[model samples]
Target: MLMRYVMSSLRISLLMMIVLGLGYNLLVTGFAQTVMPERANGSLILNDQAEVVGSRLIGQENRDQAFFQNRVSSIEYNGASGSPNYAPSNPDMLKRTSDAVKEWHTQNPDVQIGSLPLDLITNSGSGLDPHISPAAAEVQIPRISKLTGISPSKLKLLVNKHTEGRELGFLGEPAVNVLELNLELKSLMPE
Candidate 1:
């Protein structure tokens, strides 16, 4: 007799839970998934037009000669490697930074960089940062000027144009997005 009462209550509770869950999904997430933006899927698509070769949201291991370089990445934008699992004393990062520093020195033999930018050496917290510090962007002006033949002053202007300040002007340092900047560069240059 007591077992029947418990079983009936249990059945009622289960029915209520199923009804509430279905109602919430249909009224909220189902509509959101249909009406809202889902650009990640589109961003992953490479149509050989807007996207040079691969997904623009992802980073390439090698820098293209014609394009401005952004931060270095260990993951190479592979979904498996995702965010770089960096140990503070990770030998691989140190070695990679060492080689990059050597190459940077080779490329800009005269410029006194003082110390390497952390962003230049480290993969961002999110692999798709899409922006770098203004200082980092500024430092590359000389090298970019050489590659693009756009005067450093002009490049500085472009960087300034693209640079975005922090929220309310006090949260974070200014950042410039490489992909966006590169697109602007393409427009400025004739095919």
Candidate 2:
């Protein structure tokens, strides 16, 4: 009786390990690769030379005045990591937002302080959000146009072109992928 129980337990464990561990992973990977190859492979963004610049799924810190910036990052835009996950009540979070507002003011003296979007001042949950609210992108238009010598009309057109509507028309707010927008800007300027 004891020997039979041991054999049965070993058999079940082996079966489950094979099915849940190897089989499930392989099935998901195959499905992802077939259905969405670009995203399954990290949605890498390429440059003019066709070299990978970065991934569309991750954010980057762009402090240059010529480039559109993403949200303030808690992990400094490292996709392998996550945000500090600070609460709004935390004094550190308050300080960070306050400092960011000051920096934005210092950077764009012409843009009104009240006009700045909250998304631009706060870090996203993952600290790796590649997209920003359309309002956030719009707030930076004047500064980007002034620095890049791109016309406001043309920049607004570019912003519109890159703007993505809410998923299913009623889900999330409209957003613009900052990395894509900045890459397009680089292509236009080609520095």
Q: Over 4 Å off in model 2, which ranges?
A: none
Score candidate 2 by TM-score against the native.
Answer: 0.93
In angstroms, the error of model 2 at 185 is: 0.5
lDDT (Cα, tens digit) per residue for candidate 1, span 118-170? 68656777665566787777777777778778888888899899888897989
The stretch of ten residues in a row with the least summed lDDT in candidate 2 is 76-85
**Tens-digit lDDT track for model 2 on 1-191?**
99999999999999999999999999999999999999999999998889999988888888798889899988886556677788899999999999999999998898898989999999877888999998888888888988888888888999999999989999999999999998888877735
Q: Cα RMSDs of all predictions? A: 4.5, 1.5
Off by over 4 Å in 1: 1-62
TM-score of each candidate structure, all chains considered together: 0.69, 0.93
lDDT of each: 0.70, 0.89
Residue 19 displacement in candidate 1 (angstroms): 6.2
Shift of residue 77 alpha carbon in model 1, Å: 1.5
| Best by the lDDT measure | 2
Against the true structure, candidate 1 has what lDDT?
0.70
